[model samples]
Target: MRFCVSLFWLLSISSLYGQTAREIVQAADSKMRGNTSQAQITIQTIRATWSREMTVKTWMKGTDLALILLQSPAKDKGIVYLKRKKEVWNWMPSLEKIIKLPPSMMSQSWMGTDFTNDDLVKESSVVNDYDHSIVGDTIIDDRNCYIIQMLPKPEAAVVWGKLLVCIDKKDFLELHTRFYDEDGSLVNTMNASDIKTMDGRLIPTRFEMIPAGKPNQKTVMVYKAVMFNRPLDDAFFTTEKMKILND
Candidate 1:
């Protein structure tokens, strides 16, 4: 009986120690490591009678960094979204001007899309902005998942309190997410679906976000085109390219 008791204790310790800090970091790396060269982004709102689709040429090195050039639908051509660290900038074609987006406006609607400006552009946040933890094992969209809780390191920078992410076991592609308020109340829920092959990578091609307490209000994104892991030149990520693409 003494040997049986020792075996149980040993197994328990192994489980706890197995999920170490390094392992946690590795999981984060898996979650956001890759390149997306070009993508088609469409934003549709359920609460209103509106939708907009745009082709995007983009590049990224890590979370909280990278740039985007928007093309298509004529009027919105030559629009660029650039973010490095805390700063955000946009170049518009109609006026031929570069506009600086204030920090507070990040949460506002993104050019008439159902989602906010923040939602239209997804910047990887698990590393620099949030504290992460593996809450448990769960299933999402019939695939095994790792439930991770991400809370903003500084409460002031973001609008949500706690963010829950369901990462698909096979690939770290995020399957679902829920953003909570400071009081721990859920404020929004987003789901990834209609998965398809984009730029040789199989990913969820459709994204939907629904505001809590507002069932009629929801946002859906349908990818018309996506070229994953494509090589994009940094020189193309400029105000000049923004105008050229729009033109």
Candidate 2:
């Protein structure tokens, strides 16, 4: 009887640990992405000799739909990227063409930045496409955090082979993330900072992506303005909306 009780206890603890990891990931994802979100964002790409900055307007609804419209620099204006369900498309006003992005293109550089198309448009969901497990815990930026490791599901169309995320305990903010390639080599590191309240919620407004072995090269994204849980229509993510610059 004693042996059976101990075995049962061990199994129960194992199950609890697994459930807790998923719950933590779910909560953190929900905090960052509300039901609907609209934001004005600026992306700055820096290199050893040259630097470029661009502004964009973004709208996202749940995990199924996202639309991003370029808004600045005069030359790149009216460019748009839209992700609906599993499909991704890009609209180029200069060429008057809409290009459909394939799954293989998710790993390519996004606008010559350190971030990939998958990173910006979120083609694969971290909460749903990957299996989460708590590897350990640590302190980051003077805040206690839970270190979670994510492995992509077999059927999910994603670029990263592995992802390790450090999420703060108090606010569930994803403070740091390391992305790895299929060969187990580090590809990039993403750090989040400048937490502030926006739309009645606290979130990281500044994000930086640094590629491995790329000295003095990084991409910085800043959220200038953010609104969450706003009403958005399904038609907004269609290809027709991607060509409309005024809306």
Candidate 3:
């Protein structure tokens, strides 16, 4: 009788310590995006033959609103991209025109980089649009991580068939993510590193995206500065604001 009681207690304790996969994903997602965020970033595109870099400032309000303004590189400076809910638009200062992006263009590269338009705009929410499951645990960069598998819901308009996300157990930081196509083929991989304290939060400051079958091609984004939970108005995300962004 005592043995059975002890076993039951052990099982109960184990259950108490376990967390649902969705909860784990939500915790990690929440850390990356607060109520509002402003940051300066440098994007580097590296290829076998040539490479280029661009600096930009980004403002994000929740998951639905974002604005990116190119800051450096004389040719691309003053360009702005605004994402409001489901709509996306790009304002080209050189052409003096605003171009609306269609749904079909979401998968295209953003500014000739490995990151797609959907990635920069964050059109889909991983926690809400996908069913998450913790497949296993692994170590990355000497940090313990949870290997999570996310499958998109039938109604979710997402491009990736499956996503394998590696989140550090210590701080709930997303260390790596592998994206797969509908055919179960690898599309690309994104790895995060260079963890440091930014905006009073410890997070990864560098992200690298490498395409499948292209070992020599990749894009890296390094965060120079970040401020979270800053006050930002909804009007700042509008197309009208995109045109007048000077910095």
Candidate 4:
């Protein structure tokens, strides 16, 4: 009888921990992605020899729709990338053509930056595609954080083999994340800083993405302005609208 009681207690504890980890992740996600959002962002790519920069405007609704418009650099100006549901499309104003990105290209770099196409477009659902567990705890930027381990579901179409995400306990902000490849090798690290209130909500306004084994190369994205719940509809994410979107 004692053995049965102990077994039940252990199982209950395990279930409670699992629920807590998932809830933490969900709250952090909501903080980042509201019902609708718009932002002006600047991206800087730094290398040992040279650096490049570009500015963009972005709109997002829910988890399935997003549109990014390049606003600077004479050559790439007026270019747009749209994500509708699971499909991603690129519109080049110079060429007057729209290209649909294949699933194979999702793992490639986006616009010569350290971030992958999946990182920017976010076709994979972090909340649904992976199983979450609270591995431990850590301190990031002097903030206490919950270190959660995320492993992809066997049938989910995801690029990372495992992920260690450090979400701050006080505000549930994702302060740091480590992405590992299928071979269990650390592929990239993303760090968030510069916390400020944007559109009445606190958030990290700067993000740095650094690839493994490339100490001299990294990409930084800074959010210049942000607004949440800005009255967006599905029509705004269509291919036709992508071609015409401007600053």
The per-prediction tally of clashing pairs is 3, 0, 0, 0
Report lDDT (CA) for all predictions. Answer: 0.66, 0.92, 0.90, 0.92
For 1-247, candidate 1 gives per-residue lDDT tens digits of 9999999998886666444422554453543335434555666656644445555655554454557666666776667887665667788766778787887787776766556666544533445567666677798778897887777776447756788888776766787889887899987788998877766667777888888887567878777776545565556555455456544
Error of 2 at 244 (Å): 1.0
**TM per model?**
0.77, 0.96, 0.91, 0.97
Off by over 4 Å in 4: none
Candidate 4 global lDDT: 0.92
Best by TM-score: 4
Candidate 1 or 2, higher TM-score?
A: 2
> Candidate 3 residues 116-154, lDDT tens each?
998888888888889887788999999999999999999
lDDT string for model 2 (142-161, tens) is 98999999898999878989
lDDT for 102 in candidate 4 is: 93
Q: Pick the candidate with the highest lDDT.
A: 4
Residue ranges of candidate 2 with Cα displaced over 4 Å = 1-7
lDDT of 4 by residue, 1-247 (tens): 9999999999999889888988999899989889999999999999999999999999999999999999988788999999988899999898999999998888899999999999998988889889999999999889999999999999988889999999999999999999999999999999999999999999999999999999799999999999998899788889889877873
TM-score of 3: 0.91
